[model samples]
Target chain A: MHGETAPPPTGPFADPALYTEITQFYAWHMALMDEGEPDAWADAYTEDAVFEEPGRTNVLRGREAIRASITKRTAELAAAGTVMRHWMSNLAVTPQPDGTLRATYYSLAMRAPRGERPDIFAHVVCRDALVREGERWLIRHRHVGIDALEK
Target chain B: MHGETAPPPTGPFADPALYTEITQFYAWHMALMDEGEPDAWADAYTEDAVFEEPGRTNVLRGREAIRASITKRTAELAAAGTVMRHWMSNLAVTPQPDGTLRATYYSLAMRAPRGERPDIFAHVVCRDALVREGERWLIRHRHVGIDALEK
Candidate 1:
């Protein structure tokens, strides 16, 4: 909840279409990431997007930077012969005056080794800012707060 | 994938408002359930709703039956001093000609014992049919398939 500095918009949010699109976007986005498609997964972000994971090192700026990180992670997971699934809960979307959207949700990064049951890798809260680009919405910013690491 | 008898509709889905409303519904629904609100949690279902979990015994029919189960589960979890969070993934919504909606999603039941780290309790796929009654959507039928119990 950004206070008076960036108070939320009051009027009714137009563009109900974004609700479906954004929600579906995430479902596809996470599915692709889990399926190990780095390029396609990172494509959901804008050219100048910012991705920050406070618990982890490095705050990646720009799509290429994010793509590189995704590529590295994909390779690491693949080499380990593991399956990772990202689960989301309590997704709330808010529309801003500048035609941007803020989406917040709880995420669980589940990890499953070959021939083993999946376990919780990380529990996190994600706050993402998205902009409409062409026919779809793209993430302009993402901040993930790790639940376990939180003080 | 139901074949023949209950084939999925192919054409574009009408009423995009439902996309936002139904997605938000689950967000609130799961939150209420996790917070141990039985009556409110069961209020999202129809009077004669059918709830089924193949791995678990008993196919509860009617809202009262579902409410009873929710109440019992809520008490049991509270008595054990545990916090249960349900996480969903890959949510897909389809609209039918009769104005009903079918939503399918992967769900993980995570259990946290007091301050301990959370663990996956059950991994499940839920196929639910929701119908509109006046102002809001209500669950008409829900069939949960447990991954671990699957043959």
Candidate 2:
């Protein structure tokens, strides 16, 4: 029972243009990360954003901390000569009453070592709360859960 | 890359009321299943609905088949006196160009014996294509994926 706290009926993303823009925002976020642009990736989040992985109990608050975490992971992969690609699909966007957007998407991470075939390294569902400051939509909170850990 | 085939900007669910209605539909669908109503659960899908679990390669087509599958599973659980609770969160709904709605959500299934503590049994992401035939939205195609299976 979700208990009556449904999202708002319509907000900024109700408009087609804004919806497309939000989608592109996610696309660009992924592109920037894949291109090793950590600074740009961190810029995608709000100054006080919160990133959490519930399964691992890993939480990073604020844009600077999030940036450092991603940078460190990307550097580790690069140093090991590993190629990583993140594929996201089944995205759904909803408008919140407080003028924020709630975006949920499925992500699959494929990793390969130099010349080896790519293999699925992780699969997760990401729930993101996004806000628009000025003309840009930034992530306010992101919660990720890894799937099928229990037998 | 999603490759140019993006979801429609607006459709029946573009209206706030309709969006809320569709969300309620899912709520009721889950409630019906939890209440051991197999016939009602089958009614949630269209006559020619397709239910697929891609990770397990399990596919059930048509309403009757889907119903039978649910009925069978429920019966087995009942026979063992086990209780199953499905918790869904981070739901996102998108309207399709052909008048269908694409609903994506994360599901965590918890199970336990009649008098024991519940434990998570499965975690999955569900992508469903919903259609409105006569003022009611029903699922036309559902694709489910379990996380982190491939390595």
Best by DockQ: 1
Position B38, candidate 1: lDDT: 82
Report the lDDT of model 1 for residue B24.
72
Worst 10 residues of 2 chain B by lDDT: B111-120
Query: What is the lDDT, from 0 to 100, of the residue A31 in candidate 1?
Result: 97
Worst 10 residues of 1 chain B by lDDT: B7-16
Extract clashing residue pairs from model 1. Answer: none
Docking class of 2: incorrect
Cα shift from native, residue A86, model 2 (Å): 0.9
How well does each candidate superpose onto the true structure, as a TM-score? Answer: 0.59, 0.57
Model 2 lDDT per residue over B29-117, tens place: 66467557777778768889999997575799898899889899889888887665565777778877787888888876655454343
- Report the C-alpha lDDT of model 1 over A97-134, residue by residue, as the tens digit: 89899987778877889889867777776899999888
Q: What global local distance difference test value does model 2 have?
A: 0.73
Number of the top TM-score candidate: 1
